[model samples]
Target: MSKALLVIDVQNEYFTGKLPIFNRDASLKNILKAIEYANTNGIKVILIKHIIPSPEAPVFAVHSYGAEIKQEVAEQPHNLIIEKHLPGSFTGTPLEEWLRSNQIDTLTICGYMTHMCCDTTSRQAVHLGFKVEFLSDATGTLDLSNKAGTIDANTLHETILIVQASRFADVLTTEAWCQL
Candidate 1:
């Protein structure tokens, strides 16, 4: 299968910034490993950065360090770096056109905020008829306590993976995906 790796929102905002991700170190390591593997092979690597358009935004303001890709990921040799405004990478971005131009039918996704950007991208990929391989351990989410009740980070991460596996994507650990 023709494949590409989408590393979504691996930004300082989710790591060392305001919204720190759960298991930040572990997930960062896994994403780095995935990028290395993808680079060593023939797969294209696309890194998506989340940017808040408003200068007065609370976080991820454009030109802020928080909106930039983490140092480790930035040092990697990626094929493309796309800036997105929403949770889904495809929404209001050139991601779809680039994927089609590159003949990418399979997408292996890894990065921060599993319940947000990662999950949205996975579901969008399925809708676009692309096979998705979602790296469970390489994605992360924070604990939440909102109107919809509360859950810990681990539960939220696992639930997103389960939901993706049920229809949207094939959920696998970094090691498992690297094996393939």
Candidate 2:
């Protein structure tokens, strides 16, 4: 099965901006490792960037510092770079078409905000008939508090991973995926 590593929204917003990723060091390390492994194994590496159109936006505004891909990831040799405005990478983007054109049947997902972009992209992949592997340790989120309730980073991350494993994707650690 052909595979592409989808590095979703590993941007400055999560690292140096408003939304700080929990376990940033660990997750970033695993993400870089995953990319290196994919490169060595001939798997395609795709980097996704998220942008908020409004210039007044608090984070990820277009052409803003927070909207830029992290320097480490940006320096990596990637097959493609996609800009997305929504949580799901495939939404209003050429991601599905690109995957199909390249004959990629499997997507391995890793990036910031486990419960947001990562989860959404995994579900979108499943719906588009592609097999998905979610890198559990390489994706992360920060503590969230809203009208619903408050949840810590670890719990939010685990909950999303569990949900993804149930039906959307095969969730595994970065090391396990590398060994495969």
Candidate 3:
């Protein structure tokens, strides 16, 4: 299957900004490794950036440092870069057209906030008739607490992985994906 690596939201917002990702160091390492592998091979690499339109936004404000992709990820070789305003990368973005035009039938997902953008993107990819492989260790999230309940980073991350593996995508680690 023709493949493309979707590196989503590896932005400064998850590092120096308000939202700090859990296990970021390890996640970033794996993401970089995946990108390197994708580049070395013929797999297309696409970088996804998240931006909040409002300047007063708490995170990922447009033209803000937080909205910019992290240096390590930004420097990596990629075929294209897409900026998304919502949780799903395909929402209001040209991701689907680009994927189709490139004949990318298999999408390998990596990058930040496993439960949010990663999960949404994976499901969206499946719905659009594309096979999705989610990188377990290469995606991350921080502890979250809402009016409903609280969940630790590990729990939140694992829960998403389980759900993804259930149907939406093939959940696997970066090393395992590299070996494929």
Against the reference, the lDDT scores of all candidates come to 0.93, 0.95, 0.95
Worst 10 residues of 1 by lDDT: 11-20
- Lowest lDDT 10-mer window, candidate 2? 112-121
Tens digits of per-residue lDDT, candidate 3, 49-73, equal 9998999999999999999999999
C-alpha root-mean-square deviation, each candidate: 0.8, 0.6, 0.6
- Candidate 1 lDDT score at position 67: 90
The TM-score obtained by model 2 is 0.99
Off by over 4 Å in 3: none
Q: Ten-residue segment with the worst summed lDDT in candidate 3?
A: 13-22
Per-residue lDDT tens digits for candidate 1, residues 58-108, read 899989988989998999999999999999999999999999999999999
Candidate that beats the other on TM-score, 1 or 2, i.e. the better one: 2
State residue 22's C-alpha deviation in candidate 2, in Å.
Answer: 0.6
Candidate 2, position 132, lDDT: 97
